[model samples]
Target chain A: MTTTQVAPAPPGTGTDRPAVAVRGLVKRYGGRAVLDGLDLDVRRGECFALLGPNGAGKTTAIEILEGVRRRDAGEVLVLGEDPSLAGRGWRDRVGVVSQGEGAGQALSVRETLDHFARYHARARSTEDLLAAVGLQESAGSRVGRLSGGQRRRLAVALGVQGRPELLFLDEPTTGMDPVARRQFWELIRGLRADGTTVLLTTHYLDEAAELADRVGVVAGGRLVEVAPPEELGAALRRETTVSWLEGGARRSVRTQAPAAVLRDLLAVQAEIPGLSVTRPGLEDVYLRLVGATPTTSEGALR
Target chain B: MTALHATPAEPRGLERLRWAVADAVAAAGRDVAHWRRQPAAVLVAALFPVLLLLMFTYLLGGGMVVPGGGDYRDFLVPGMLALAMVFGVEATMTAVVTDTARGITDRFRSLPMAPSAVVAGRCLADLAGSVVGLAVLLAAALAVGWRPGGLVPALAAVGLLLLLRLAFLWMGIYLGLLARDPSMVVAVQILVWPFAFLSNAFVAASSMPGWLATIAEWNPVAGTVTAVRELFGAPVGTGGGWATEHALLLAVAWPVLLTGVFAVLSVRRFQGLSR
Candidate 1:
């Protein structure tokens, strides 16, 4: 019940410490361990994205850290205190935007936001929140009547209104339109620019790549890989696959030197059919890391 | 606004009480806020007990009798008030189950707001609504020519009704947390009817068979009904049991006991929801 753990420095104090630290987090449902001894550390003032497939314990792990769900065994420190045992002061510094709809349907959009804002000693004004989240027009609309995207934006607004020291966002942009998604990214970027610590879990790799300082891929209840988006699957990224037509059959070679392979193929034939070099992007590296067969447009071209 | 990421420790004593009251008011205000957008729904819920009062008083009243000789209206009116208090429980359960099911309860829990704020707020809000419903039913009772005893006793009767309501509010809240799904509450709502009829809220328990009378007399609703009938100077039939003999005491004890039991159960269930 008690363990020595470093607490995150006060916001805007400019210290480098893990805003969230998890050690041996174990959660079981009906004798099946959803989170099997997962360990992770997300540093302060950075956006860390957790990527995983469905039922990979990403949600379970996030809820545990948020203090919404309990863990069988784990040492968790969010802003330096155990989430499950954390009290009001802990909740004050932590902001959570859980997945799915939780806003009261009876209240108007503005009213819903106002109600949550009262819980915080400091909070953004309702006008600013509505304007920032682009819900200004629907401010008077019932929460239940708003579109899915609008509701998601409202959730995001509620999460950040407290100007939390640590923010937990679970699939924040699931139902957002392209413009809304872009706007959401900008909003997050603004928060990060303020030295806020954000932990995001999302299915969209591009979203992870676009926003994450580092992305951690989780599978089977543990981190498969955690690295900067560019540095993720470096070995996989370094290898290039060259595919073309040979003897009326498609052929491909994965190699460190694709230029030499292309030149040698051209030396054999005046014009190489389907001669293309493909480097695995974040998606490919992610797909392969999660044990999915990474495919490229060239594969579908054939 | 003064930002409080600076205060690592929570405030103590009076400050904590201030937060508790403020948070409870805010959460309770949320329920009242719902009434603004859905006035019709609120009106219907308030008037529902009045409908039952008319039905039982006019249609069912002719066949009913008080054992010791009094107007059937006198006996039936007190019982109807208790019945009305029990009936409002459906509203309490539905609101709670819907709130918990839709994830608002989780959201409430996640906030830094006072720990007991949501529940106390719900208690305040529901009890306030019950007060309004009670007023409406009382107005209907007066319109129907059902007279009662002195104002002081009548006030005591009203207190008993509200106390019974407070107890059921916890009971409903407990059941709602247990179910966590609004659909499951439908079964409970259906079950309330048989529960209401089984109490002496309708006929005098003395008229039933010996065993049935004992069971009905012991029903909490019957305890409240019988106590209020005494308070209103109505015929409280001759029944030979500890429950009937001490109606006023049982009336107070039953609700207080139920409130303690269910409040603990509801809060514990809410805290363990993650498990």
Candidate 2:
């Protein structure tokens, strides 16, 4: 009997070790340090997002990891090889959809995808890629004629043609409409399901919450905090606020188990006054963390 | 679509070379498709030189005089061919700078293609367009009763013109990489017209006054134009100077030197760009 797995898993892949690993990475421009000793790790088959404000070193860090830019000092590894020294073999296993990047404007969308497709020995068919990115209707139009969001989707389409094990998407949905963003999320989900490890950089809070397995809040050239979207920050995350009236007095208590408290309260009486369960949402904690860290200097210097 | 990559390891031997060639060809083919998609732009680009050629032949031909006895049209044809080669240099630089500005250059550098493929592709694409432009100008010259003489010499003249173009493209690549923004290109574009006209590309260099004539003779464009004129059996610029007298030698030497210098500068610039 033959098993059907469309993606041919490369050797030495599917390991327990993280897909991306960086330790004390340092990069500077002029005299100012843009990335001052940043550390990060992205697990295999997980979507890790570096969420930050403008000039939080998110783009610089990602660029260094992608090997488009070099670091001043420190150890960095992607797929078990130092990115700066990695060869074409490493490139074959990694895909990049860089911000502000687009193929030739003079060429049609299909032609643009086809040109990039030729670089990969085993590439997705242009038809499948066009359909996947929802650009089939505009496949015949010149890249210059496409809208900004349409062009971005084409960039995403080109990035995934090689079926890379590790995909780097830098602000991939920055300009997409709500509907297009939803569609793009589905495409990323498909890649995640197929075991692709993704590293994304975005300032869009919802985009990060909707996709990232874990989000790292970067500021002051460092990751101030990192956790899953639902548990990003704050001591209040695990605690639920249980408020009610005890006898004639208004009372409130924060505890890990609101259900147990509610059951006990119901046993005491038929109804509890001002009964409400409240917990700190991811947005509340995120604003508190990112807003508190200083990232303004990086953008100003750049 | 099935295999993640062609090989688990870095492609060795023939596989590497095959893909390298494929990447360069694919990159070049992108430009070809661009022309096919926008025939109007291609037509305008191809016709601009022909318009200049026709205008000079009819408009200015009657009033002009070659130092040696020859029809002005005959002299202008070869000069224009060499000058037209300089025109494509700006296009190459614009392409390079635009790519850099759009982050397209960075994207290409991140790919798994051969190191030289990007430059090679641009050269191939520009060279392809240059050849077509040359052919159109030659046809226009023939229609205007200007003969470029025998096959052997004509082909050699075409070779020198293309060599001049190759030299300029390397310079374009270096400058374009440095500019990185389309807005910065206007200064160079404005300067190109004066640079082209200051040579013997339009009127004979000897026709200008003493010091100016000497400068025109030594102009790199003048050397190629004069050499091409000699090859086409037209009147060569008779200015008395080392560069003027040594047309054929300077024709080959200037381009070879320019190509060597700019290619090195451009490659070094590109290597340092990502950092």
Candidate 3:
């Protein structure tokens, strides 16, 4: 039964049909709501990043959208079909790089990708996929023998081998080194350019800022805010910090306009030594947005 | 790349069946690859029963008496074959449990392949290994002066042994799915040894205490062992009860019943897996 619980449409779910849409999604575990009446929409050809702290239902929400999980109540549509009712065709259209390392340990890299490729009607060539993930040299290496980052890359290669129209990446770069993470970002960029809709969840603020077309801040079992990363950063707090050294003391002022404060300071003196102006970064805003609850603390960021 | 973007329609009827068979075959190949990668482990598992056959036939056969006054080696050979069938449960259990705990099972579930393919493949590979193990054990039995009665009955005995293996395979799958860790395979192994010994696999049920004899005679392993011994014309008329008297009937029925109960349970457990 595809229970299309007609929730009031989310803002800006305009004419272009979303690749994924969920309405009033409620999932309960042991009578506690992991996802409580959450609504989300990811537009076609856009990177939608879902951000939340640990145990905030990001993985649960992703699994439901991927059609591998059942929601207690709500409407969910992935690729225009209810995920619960979706079949192999729907599965073909979606690729999931889950948080856990799901690769078969005994299979070599190329063999693993080749095995998964057969499940899809059409799949990218193993050579191309291996090269894309920079794993061509390790194609003969067993999955268990690969380093953590290499295994993650192999997983991504498997995820994209089918050339899915929609992709779900759950912490895809969790164990990647900086260089590998950047390489993975390039792969994501390439996928996005090819018009694959992506819904990603990650704890990394910079990943969301670097890749997301729009970012959603999930807190208290719901998305409290969804917007582009810059707008999200700005909307949470507009205050800018202007700091300068004066008479052997450091003075800092928070204001809406750093330029005005700098001008005022310049009017009184020739120049302010060690002067700098900065706005709250994505990490700071994310912390304040999802960290407003009682349990939110400095350790939450860590 | 453009062609790859298109989603294939859901397979229908014969196409779906074909895909399911192909998926299962591929899944079986995966397990075969595991065996190939670990040839030593596979060799040991396959040959362990032969070692036991030698130990019992030579070391312990001196003190044993056959019910019908025949060589105990002939009697012990077929019994060991049945015991070998029963022993495969541990291998199947460990493989299934490790797959579940390692996330490979979940990965298979998430794929577009047929839902039944994974278990079907596992059954295929395990049964194939059991067949090989039987062949090796039987060859060793022949080398040690055990002669078969007829080709047809010997083949029938082998069939019963395989059927027993298939029945235990389902039980193994169910237990593996129920276990939370691969360490539970040890518990299964420990329990299986006692279960095997308590049956007529290594001793005559008639020699046990009255109540123990009844339990041993009724054991599924005992049924297969007794049935195969009759088919191979090694020993017979070791009366324990009506069930023991009708060994062949019970042998067939035991496997069918075990497969029915445990297959249902394994399927239910598989379908209930949310992770």
| Tens digit per residue, CA lDDT, model 1, A1-302 | 12222344554564565788898989999999989989998888789999999999999999999888899998988877677777777788788898867788989999998888888878989999998889999999999898999999999998888878788999999999999999999999988877778999999988998999899999888898999998999998998988888779988877777887777777767898877789978888888898888444333322
lDDT to native, each model = 0.85, 0.83, 0.84
Off by over 4 Å in 3: A1-13, A241-277, A292-302, B1-8
lDDT for position B57 in model 3: 85
- The alpha-carbon deviation from the true structure for residue B99 of candidate 3, after best TM-score superposition, in angstroms, is 1.7
Best by lDDT: 1
Which pairs of residues clash in candidate 3, taking residues 3 or more apart in a chain or in different chains? none
Top candidate by DockQ: 1
Question: Candidate 2 on A106-207: residue-level lDDT in tens?
Answer: 888887888888777578899999988899999999888889999889999989998888899999997889999999999999998888889999878888
Candidate 1 local lDDT, residue B127: 92
Model 2 residue B202 CA deviation (Å) reads 2.0
**Cα interface RMSD of each candidate:** 6.4, 6.4, 6.9
Q: Where does the lowest 10-residue lDDT sum fall in candidate 2 chain B?
A: B1-10
Residue pairs clashing, model 2: none
Superposition error at A138 for model 3 (Å): 0.9
Residues B155-182 of candidate 2 have per-residue lDDT tens digits of: 9999999999998888888889888888
